[model samples]
Target: MESVRTCVGCRARAPRAALVRVVAIDSQVVLDERGSMPGRGAWVHRTHECVDAAIRRRAFGRALRVSGSLDTQTLQNHFQRNG
Candidate 1:
């Protein structure tokens, strides 16, 4: 069976395949397209609304258990290109 995860932005439960996995590396948020990154993972929908909410609520740091601001430019770029 497919795993379920919560979207940090909307706080809604969704199947793993319905959401995208994000991970932190070197204090930067990176998109895990393959969902095989080695680190704490946070899941969120690919919509700009969800991404915006996640950033607005500062959910990444909390979800990833990090203690400082994280760079989300890469995340934004992904959305921009794919959005």
Candidate 2:
């Protein structure tokens, strides 16, 4: 069976390939394009809507199991550059 993960933004359960993996490192949220980051990770749709939703809901910290604010510039830049 295919692996499934829920989007932290939309909370929708979807195939692993349908979502992007993210990891928190040093209070910054980074996109794990290869899905091989070594830590707790969160998944979200590739769309901006979902990304913004996750930010609005403060899902990153909760999903990554971090206890403080996270810098998402890298994540935002990735979307802006490649979205």
List the candidates' TM-scores in order: 0.96, 0.95
Rate residue 23 of model 2 by lDDT.
96
lDDT of 2 by residue, 1-83 (tens): 99999999999999999999999999999999999989999999998889989999999999999997899988987887777
lDDT of 1 at 80: 80
Runs with alpha carbons beyond 4 Å of true place in candidate 2: none
Per-prediction CA RMSD (Å) = 0.7, 0.8
* Model 1 per-residue lDDT tens digits across residues 1-83: 98899999999999999999999999999999999999999999999889989999999999999999999988988898899
lDDT of 1: 0.95
Q: Which stretches of candidate 1 lie over 4 Å from their true place?
A: none
Q: lDDT (CA) for every model shown?
A: 0.95, 0.93
